[model samples]
Target: MNEIILKFSKESPQVKDTPIEISVIDVQPDYLYKFNAGIDGIWTTIQDFSEENFCIWKPKIDGKYTLMIQGKKKDGKKSFDAAAKADYIIGAVEEDIIQSVNIDRRELLQGEKLSVMVETTVKPVMYKYWISGKDGWELIRDYNSENEFLFTANEPGKHEILVECKTIESKNNFDDFRTISFIVSEIEKVQITDFKCLSTELLTDKELIFQVDARHEDSRMVLYKFVKIDNKGKALCIQDYSSKRMISFTEREPGSYKLLCMAKDMYSTEDFDDRAIIVYDIKPYKPIVIKSFTTDFTSPQTTGTKILLKAMVEGGRNLLYRYMIEGKHGEDSGFIRNNSFLWETKYPGEYKLSLYVKDESYSGDYEECTSLEYLVEEKLFKPVKIRDVALSKDKNYVKNKPINITVSADGGNELRYSFIVYKDKEEVEKINFGIANWVNFTPEQSGEYELEIRVRDKYSHKDYDSHTFIFFNVRDYIPGIIDYILIPSKEYYMVEDDIEIEVITQNAKETLLKYCISINGHPVESTEYSKVKKFKFTPKVSGKYNLEIYSKNIQCKEGYDEKKETKIYIHEALPVTNTKIKSSLVKAKRNEEVTFVVNSEGGKDVCYEFYLMEEENWKLVQRYSKKNYYTFIPFISGTYRLLALSRSFYKKVSYEDYDIFKLEVN
Candidate 1:
């Protein structure tokens, strides 16, 4: 039993000149299909030379088409004329079709990317995209099957994106077009957050504390500055810009004061990222007096190390505080709201740490500060002692190859090493005690060698603090190339034929091979050293070419092995195009023999195979061989469908060309 099914690349309602693919599915045994199409019940044969199951075609006229598939079976004495048909319509081309275009965002900042997609009634054949920015129009993408694109907003201004769509078989540049516009702005600026006065009283004698908070994108660092403006509008610097957002100060001549606080990003390019102002009047208040200032820290600490100072005050309100370090590395902590500080210095000596406190507003720079003595002893590091020197010297070392030596030591803050190489009894190379602890030494000549490593800290003054040594040997190598051969052993080389190279080697460890080419005794090209065992060379043009190959050891100073092939001729190639299948009889009786022959053109050493698609799968009637003919005899009554496939001996693919033929046995 046999049933036919048809599949098309495009559905009905297609227009003229639209390419379409048709596939026939007949899995039943002894079945093959013949395709034909027409408008009415009567169908005309379609002249398409394709596979027995598939074909491609384009409709030239606009109308409805009825496609018919005639099926047959390869057997004896049974009628196998099973048939199936399908309908396809060719509609008129419609103009002014609508397309859908959408964008991810309408507004964005410069340096951001936007996504857009276009949609139509059917899949378009091609799409073109263009972007219009401050620099006029630019083609973003050319004709392609993609419906989406990512547009980058590099300029700060109005921008537009245009997309053109083309459906199947359309000749115009675009069948439908759509556009979208967007606006891109610059980077966001900073703004001043809320500012608060932490002090209880605004008086001249008392300490006043002010804290400002601001942030632009949480992870960005913000620095703050505080300035005081008098009644005369003249600005005086209270505290310069710093990462600390709190400040404490005492105003002696306090009247009407306007405080300006500004916040900015640490790396912001603007004058001020954000700013805020505060207006207030100062009145006379009680003087600030330090009652009992307590501090905690282990003294006699090492220099060049960070130490924390934990401080607590019992003064007025402790609303404002300041710290000053007096020594070789002096620094002022400026008036801040925090009481503790971290100090570090490279110099070691006597030092004094002082802290001043105030309650609220200030009158003058009087006293409310306490001092603490610190003994910063010099930090000493131990001399570098050689611990372990690891090396892989058991393996044979060849001349001219690099030897790497590395050493590790203990008990040094900053250690330096000196590598000394000795050949025989004489010194060859040496690096002074520097930060480098690893070195590579290449032996220029075969010899007995010794490597010595010495390590010392920067503070050590002796000739060496710790030393170690190792011994190794280097040996010379011999180079030789035995022979080489070319594939396809042809007298005349073709212009487009691939030739393989096979090389045999002797004492081949670390041997480098080079391929040199020349034309008529003039050198044209030479390749670098490689271990090429399976190299393919394809000739592009016909010429009298000379090919030379050489092998040598990279570690050896001079000797090499060479081979050459001279004055080889290359000719143009002939291409295999197709094969034609012919049959002796179109109809035959039961048990009658049928003969089929295949003919080929421009083929080189061609071979043929005969196959029959009579059932669920094709059965091989004849395997690939030099004989170009096939003989067939049928038993069960049906039709015989034979396919001939031809391939060249040198071709890598399965078959170059094929043809189908039919024979009916009644």
Candidate 2:
């Protein structure tokens, strides 16, 4: 292969519009050659020549570009290829010479000298200086080698200084120059005539106004500055510059302070005039209070009344009021923002009512608490009397039974009772019942007895007591012969089965009493009988039953009869032997409907119950009485049973029979 290569005179990055020379080596003669240049990595044909070895390229825009050259024979065969790349950055055609300038001061009084100097990084071939004042810029130095100059400002205004230079590389370039400005004004003299506050003595957090009076030689604007001098003679600026004549300041610390006021013109060699000082004395704050307090009502107030309580406080911005009654804080007492409150009286007595007042200043150190005693007299109550007294039971009671006694009274809030029991006109027992109205007593022996109840109001005197009495007969109590009975003698029983219920007695005293028997809640028989009481009962239907037995003697009272109850269970009996169901298939698909017909020895009124198998238990699905057959579709694959129950129209006993069927579902 014939190889082609490209070379450049300068490999460094070139500025825009700068020319670069490129040469192509090892070129094949009389063969087609192409030179390509890329802008931002894209290659394009720049020139296509047959035998050229060198080319000039000047980039107009600044960027990185790739240059490529390729050569081939006229028959379209590859011969040589070369490439070169460089970056081009934008730059000025000439270098910048002016760096910076320096001046002694920017502000000066009239007739003051000003010094200015110029500096440059590159050596300049020429230098020029000028000054701009009331007239246009006047040439002060032309083509001078020295870069520094001095001038005086006689007029009061702004003046501009300019310096122009040229580098040795480009002498015709005058674009590089440095300019600076300064201000000059006439001097003025001022003095402070008076500096005094409204009051020299002040309390903490109190404001004082300080007025300044000054005179100026020139009719220029004057400024006032206030400085505070501590006990150590250190000055601190309170107000820097204020055009106003008076200023207000508040002292927050207890100390002695010296306030100095200075007056000066807008432009002066001396910064401030003779300052006038004022001494101030600040003292710690002490709150003032007036202790005049009063209430809406006087002493000896009636019980159960509402009274208004108030405190008139003066000379405090934030005041707190608290109230108490008889050493107990009232409900409206803690930190009250208001001064007045309502007090509801509770009991009839003398009470100490107190009021505590405080100001929210200085951590509530200044507080005033005062107390006064008041009397609450009791209201007169009417005399009370016993209206009626009653008993829970009849006055004639058994000898050993307890009786409840209660009383009704009028015109009193509280009452007392005294219960006394007497026998044969002699006191047996006396009970001080206190505030209770009822008492229970048991007479030891059967005899004539009397019960007396005395009642009195809580506020009644001994002469106001009332008494009442009732005569009662105590009778002897007799015991029963039989206590209870237990039936079936087992946990459960079956229907149509003969069950013997045993009768049990307290002492086996059968000859002294008459016995009555009831089974299934119906009376069976009653007689003066033996102890065994032999009887047989057969339940017709499957269910639960209750058996009751009562024993009584003719000589005993009517309520002295003893009774007992027993619960029994009777299970269902199997149906007749010949009862069955006729089905087409013993096992069928779950989605298919199966029919069952009842087949029995004799056709009669029968109810059919269908049960499905669910979780090891049989669940009744449906029951029908008017139809002899049942049809159902099983949703789940399982075993099922059908119960055929028959009962005669005149008898309560029912007979049942069941058959199982299996099913499968896909």
Candidate 3:
């Protein structure tokens, strides 16, 4: 029997063919072969030159197992095979291990597309390239078959491309793979480096300066837009600048505004970068214009009335406005020196009103003038004046006489005069004379009379000019005083009541006098009065009598007699004192304590009887008692009376009085 040997670069003891000493080149091969029988007719050869090294072995038992290597002939495959049987096993390993998976890009920008090229060297396209965490590797353009793969980055992030390669084997299959890491960073659509305002003064024809930077892994022509904001802060239409470094906004109107700069790559229109700037227009401020001026009432009377004038301006201008009044006499200043003015006229005349307005920012004098014409007349509503006022008592009046008043006015129209005669600022008489030259008034009552006579012109409205005088009313000077004194008595008189009232006068005075007699303050008209002064009367109702006499002269002046009273007490029998007691709810709770009191009908401490009665027929609580007062308390709730019978000190005074009282205890 003969044995065969195989060799490998690294040891694998599972194989039977072991070689004693194997060459480094022959140890790892594209394929391995084995034999164990005597040689019949097999020959070994390297069929194709595909891998770096292709080995063959023809083991035959002509005498023993033998090896043959087929590689480059000059390298002497026979010499290497003879040494393999001594020490090496037939194991194979790949010579080319994947060192790394290399990618073209490391970082990518957002919304940017980039083509990535993958490079690797392994036999027979040993490794399939894959973008890790995604499906199979996507080929962008087929160049160099699958040996080189191309892909575009869709997102910005770190990514891995995995390369898996396998080496062919005779007995045990073996493979090797590795991963390459890459990053995709965010990218700007436009490359505007210096997007800023060049100068604020040139904002009307504003110029924007910007620069595009080509620092990305991919180069692309980009479109940029420069937008300017109006004074209202609204974004205007975007202005396109193709690959331009400077954008100008000369088409914009004059004002302060802002500018926004953005950029877009020709490939990706969605990506943008922005910046802003401020602008101001340095134009002169225009003065506004005055439009119109007028008044509330342009026509006014000259009798001390004020005329108002108002001035208005427009067109956003500052104005100095004033009004002046010029007439035949002279020009006069008005109440206000600006805008609105008031002019007062002294008398009935024609007047001129001139309104002037000036742009104070541009000139020191007025630029606009407005004028109005006004005619003045005597006042329609003048105050009334009273003159030539006379009273019937010669203006210096006597007492209690009919007074006549006359009032007249001098100018204007015929007037309706109203006369109010007052004794002391209080109206004594009122007379309305209809459209008269003069008015007459008579005072019915005399004192110090103040006459207020007001005359209002029929055409004008006015009142109150007064003529006042003082007078006295003497009693004897009045007509009605009794000349003859008469004492008359009534034809009939009752025995208990009689009185006489007398009438006296110097002439046949028609004055009626009233006489009254009263008991206390109450009148007793039922009592008869004697017609004569010498007549007599008997008192009926026993009480004090008061006589009051009242008279007045024809002038309505009051004269009265003082009260005369006489006291009399009448007695037909002895007077006795009666008594009673009063209280509410004598039986009550502890919080509602009870109190009782006795009441009497006469003077205190008179002799009387004291009794306590629970049932009918009261018993004498005080025997033979002269005391008029007593007190008692019931132990329980019941009804009782504490009686009192009092007698007066006079011989005819004796009485019985009793108080019924109820007691309650809680």
Candidate 4:
């Protein structure tokens, strides 16, 4: 069993109809209790508590309330009871209602004072004032009987002024609050003036200075920020927190720009002023005069030759060069972005070449020009004069006898000679000499022979001279002949390859003879033979073959005949095995070096030739005698192919190998 005790907050004092607290102590840990408070002795349950010992009670009517508690112990074996009495006086409730809220100014500048007041219907025991802004609500004043508040507006924008009234007489409901809105604007206004650059038009690589005047009416220190803006409204640079009124900057390039000056008070950033000044014609340095104009060749140059005109300049950036050619008939002019000009003379005349250089950075306003005169001479058409024509041997001719005719000419850079031999007015043989003065011929047929020699200057078509000689008596003697042969042009051939055979007789020019040719005992039927004979033969298989030639009736003799024999060998051609590149990619970047290698099998000492494909033709790039690889560096971007030709040392036939590569520069 446990004992219970009861307690009252106001044991013997009289209080108004306010809230009071009652408690029970020294009870069992797990006991149940019932509490009652009323004027009547009849117990009306107010609370049933199992573990709590205290409670708050508000009396509605004036009465001597009986505070009682009844409880049982945890064992349910014993019961207990306790009682106390308290007096409460009923009074009139206070109605806490706000009548009005007012402010002296709705809008004011920062650092200015604002007055706020609040009025309530019932008298409040205390008043609280709060100011709410971006930083949230803050209590300004909390005191008894204070209905008004005054404070400085420190921050800008809308602010809330809240006032709370409280009366302790109204138990649990005695607070009245109201809020009013006001605005605080910035106090200082800054003005920017005298915004100017010292020089709007400046030369390149020169400094530019800008100045501005700024002030504020509130007598606060002014701050400045300068920005250089380009024509596209993009800020090139910004100088922040500048204390000085002037700024200096240098630009190496020339362009259009603007200087923006912004001024603000040091105390506030909310108010500021800005002004812009346009700067123009930032130009390059002045153009230098053309010091000299000269040509590569001397005056009186021959027609159809190129002459180079060069102009020397001292100082100018991005210069535009203009060249003018003033001839006797008309004038030709053009512009180039370089300093050199090439001129080719088409006609013989005197002309003036003028060079004008202007600075493109200044819109071609500054220029320097100079001119020079020169002449072009025409090529002369001089006829070739033949001093004499003579024969190596005497004019009387014999059969199978060799004779040489020589001519002397005076004219032109180059002279051409032609020889014609006629037997009884029928022209039999003609020979042309290029840059040579003599020709050799053998009189095979004995007759009255007329030989004519003609000479001409290479530059003239109709200016020529000739001489004629007549041989009166002709006779026949014992004839002797010599034979020379050339096979495959270099004495080498391949299987299935076309072979050309040429035969030359040393002492006979016009004697016709009958001949029989054979290859490996296979008879080749050819009836006639000339002084120099050529024929083609294609070998079908690979082997060694003996070629034989037999000629009869030498120099029209009755029983004079000769026989000759030669041997030729033909072999199979080797194929190009592979073409490789050392680089990782066949496509490369411009200006990159690439290496190409070629390989061949079954060839002794291969010769390699590299070619570049240009405009549908393969141009020979280089030839390697005994090497197999080549290195190439491309300067431009385009599609390119490398052709590698592998050929043997003695054969004209080659095996072609190629690979394609691409370059990208941009």
Candidate 5:
């Protein structure tokens, strides 16, 4: 026969040695009494085992409970009662629920704290808890209801947490176990930055101060390390540094220096990793000088001034040195000296001065430098003198018009000459002829004329001492007319007439004049005297008449010239004795043809006479005779007389003066 027991717990497996307890209860009367290896067969009769110990049942699954058995011995003995079946009703129980197993954090830092928790539920009751690992858990707090267990991790790694449950209270059998595993981890790490320097990259007798950075979450100190790196990447740690942040070195020889730096956290308490770097070299530097430079100072009058010079020096530093002088008196004072120097002079004759320079430091390897110089000059200008002078036309005294002044210089071309002419103390003419002697002038008014001429010599180079002056004048003249008269004089008989009279004065200076001729208060055309100063006229009829002349003076240059008036008597011709007739013969058709003709001898105031043989009276042709000749054609045969007679102006001449001619018929 077998026995069964149940128990519970909520602590880790290490705190308590076991989790359950087992004991016998009651057994059924039946045939199953087989017992082996501490697990027993089904119990049947309580009375049959009441004298012996009962067996335990280890519960591993869920199901309804009953029992049946056949009685058997460890040996081959058997009985029929042990084979009978037994049935009993037992209460069902569940395994404790292991709800969760987990770490408090997924990630962890260096040595920070971490935790693990186990959560569970009892199916029908509470359970015992335990964890399996190298180091046991540190229990923090506990909520005991057979449901949860929490603990802190002492170290880092995987651990197995477990729980077990049973129906008995003792520390053995009929129990169940459930488990889960978890993990933990370790911490973080450190580095450095390269060094920086500000001095010239190629060093020549120079030193440097530098800086670098350390990289870690914590603060730290760095060490400076300097080394000389060869052509390869291998590193060597150098120790003679002045500071972790800065250092200086004196350059002795020329080569390259390699460098490094390192840092560590103060908390790390150890030296930092070697990682920073810097590199460079060293050589020589210097400069040079110049000495003793000079110029000249004396000379002659026209030549102006002079200059003089001298000097000494150094080499490789200057390589090739030069010297120069300029400004006032410099034209005569310039010169050049290379390498070394000596005394020198110039004759440019100047008053202002200056100097110039060049050397080897400025010119590269193979070339030399060139130098230049300058200076200013000075001078004085002079004037001239004039002696004898003359003119072309001479007057009784100084004239009111232009004249010539001829100047003569004893020094000739050596003189610079100038001239001026004055009238009544006022300047009228002036001229400059450079260095020449003769010049001319014209003045406007009559006065005491004064002429001045000046002359200068070239050798003195100045007008302040060697110049001369001279003086003279011109006279005025007025001209005149010699002969005079009116033109065309004698009057005989009838032809038209004109007369012009003029005055013949020696000097008649005048603008416009007027003239007239008159007879007894009426106008006529003649001059009263043959020498009248002026006159004019024309005649239309012939007669004896009185003649007169008059003139008005407009303007005359001579203040005393005169106006004019005069008279005379004139005679002209009557045409009577000078008369003659011209005739033309005509042939009519023969009914007794007849004609008459006459030419008149008379002035404009005249009429013609006509006498017919048949008429007792003489008929006059009132308008015909002024033509000098007349003609008549008679219708019947008869004799006629054609006569011309004089009319007005009879008192001035003879009235018996007439002309007659006859006419005949066949």
Candidate 6:
């Protein structure tokens, strides 16, 4: 006999008035269980355990009791097999009450299930529920040992529920109670959303079926009515109100007709919840569907390679297929009934293959069409791009200077050109290809610049037919004076001479030459600077004149390109034009008292200086003075020469004119 043992977890002594569940871990399926309690060393059967459920016990008084379970032989009689017992202490009255009561659904529509669950602070408690619904307050459920209840919401309105729970051994009405409110909405009327017919599906002779779509929240039985409306404004009932959602007809009428459907619940209050109508034009039926027209191709093969391209036709009768495949090096397009085509790919590039299909009896262009991408290639040849062409010019470059580029292309077709400029290895400007064969560019900064010129035919498919580039550099711009010229080259300039001073400048392109001229320590003619490269002036009086030239570029403000100064003397014309030495004799003896006076024309306060030749040397007979005449007496002279010089009273250029005379003494 196996020893029987009872496991009691009600220790630390459970409440006296509370019920405890007694369950046995080891029990035979063909046995009846008997639960007993010990009273003064004697075991008394307190409750009988059913095979379907465990036995529950509620202690009447506080005491130490032994709880035991006996395994029996049959369901009717007690044939003891093994017994197990566990001692338990029953304290005073236990206040096992409900901890919380909650309704699983807070709001629901009619015909939906709502559950109320009750939880207690301890197990083995009784729950009861009272509901105030559309029928007013009533005891919906009596007290039960179960902790929850589920029921369908039949009535519509705000339903208030009251739940109460108490210990199984408690004699009181309730230990705890809770109140909760929820609303049960009325069942929504059924709405007929749409009436549909599968026109593409095949049916038997004179057979038609349309599906009806309806919406509702109620679980009640629904009925749908179908009506047939002809183009003549006549209506006929095709289907009466029934539980069927689809209507079937055997009418072979071949005119335009409207099919209408009305849907509603069996117990709805309205005449018809919702009605839907669909226009149907009945005609002789023939089905043709080009579900998909697809093309299949294998990888590319070498030259003279034959590729079998197939067109996949899914659904259609007597369908004709057409194919078109195109690439740069090869292309094929044809229309045929055969599903496969043999293609020889001569190009090595990406290709797109299109397949089109149409039913023989169909009037439309095509029923279905699809495209496929495949390539037939060999070892890839070099890319024949538009390159190795160049645009060049033999010239120096400067900043902010514009230059023109002329493309020299020998293509047979119309040409186009594009220009791109890069400064310091970075692109700064670009012009796209167009019909024009020339491009103009301006350098913006001083650096290494590259101009790339690309050309192509106007209708060429490639990016360009030829392209070339040239590298060049730009030097920094600094204004400079080239040179200056004094017009009319001459030894000396008279006081009234019109002097032309022309200055030249070597500055940046598009930069003008501004001149600032000054003479005699003052700004002359043009005090302000201007674009005056050539300046002319007439000096009224004779004086030493200072000529200064300042040339500058327009981009500068404070300084000039170069500063140049030159000194020029402008004198008055010779005032004394003719002068002569007048003597009493051409030859005179020593101390002969020869009177040699200077007589001159065109003179004013003239001062004369006299000189005589003696011993192969000229000697001054008298210094310059206000005296115009002089006395000459030769002392020892074989042949004597006397000279007279005259000038203006001011004698600006020493002496303007002079005369010489030959005198002899014998």
Top candidate when judged by TM-score against the true structure? 6
Off by over 4 Å in 4: 1-188, 199-206, 215-219, 250-254, 269-271, 277-281, 284-315, 318-353, 358-666
Ranking by lDDT: 1, 6, 4, 2, 3, 5
What is every candidate's alpha-carbon RMSD to the true fold? 36.5, 43.7, 46.7, 42.2, 65.1, 49.5
Q: Candidate 5 residues 513-576, lDDT tens each?
A: 3344444445544322122345455555543444422222233234322334444434354444
Report the C-alpha lDDT of model 4 over 1-666, residue by residue, as the tens digit.
334576667643344556677777565566677676645334566777466677777766543344556776555664553333332323332444778889998998776789877877866456767676654455587646877778988789988786666675644322556678999988656777578777554777776777888656654567788878776777865577556677777867666877777777665545445555655656677547775576644465657766667676766767778888888644444556877887877788988877878876555533788877877778553334465667776643677878877777674568787778888778998876567788887878766676766666576444243333435345574333437766655555777787777766544554333445445444555555544466567777656666655444344545444556677876655544455433344677777877766666666566777777644566788875768677777687766676767666765555544444332332
lDDT of 5 at 286: 26
- Judged by TM-score relative to the true structure, which candidate is superior, 2 or 4? 4
List model 2 lDDT by residue over 523-545, tens digit each. 55565534445546776766656
Work out the TM-score per prediction: 0.23, 0.25, 0.22, 0.26, 0.20, 0.30
Candidate 3: segments with Cα more than 4 A from true spot = 1-292, 312-319, 329-338, 347-352, 358-360, 364-369, 377-666
The candidate maximizing lDDT is: 1
Worst 10 residues of 2 by lDDT: 84-93
lDDT of 1 by residue, 178-266 (tens): 66898987656667768888877887776788988775766557778899998889999877777778887887765888899988766
Worst 10 residues of 1 by lDDT: 290-299
* lDDT score for residue 101 of model 1: 82
| Collision count for each candidate, in order | 26, 1, 59, 0, 65, 4
Residue 298 C-alpha lDDT in model 1: 36
Whole-structure CA lDDT of model 5: 0.41
lDDT of 1: 0.71
State the lDDT of candidate 6 residue by residue for 1-666, as single tens digits.
Answer: 455645554653566678787777766777767788874455678767556325778887654566777776664344677677665656543354667778877888766789888777787777878776433345678788887889777778887777766777877556666667899888877877767885443323455778987787555788888888988989999777887787666555556888888888776656678898888776434444443333222343334444556554555557677777767765545557897777776666788877777766557867777776765567332211232333344455667777666655553356677888887667888889777767666777777787777765577565554555666666455565646545567777777789887766664342345444444444554445566667777888766777766666666577666667667777665468768777788667776777787877765677888888877898888888879777756677588788888887765566888999887886
* Residue pairs whose backbone atoms clash in candidate 4: none
RMSD from true fold, candidate 2: 43.7
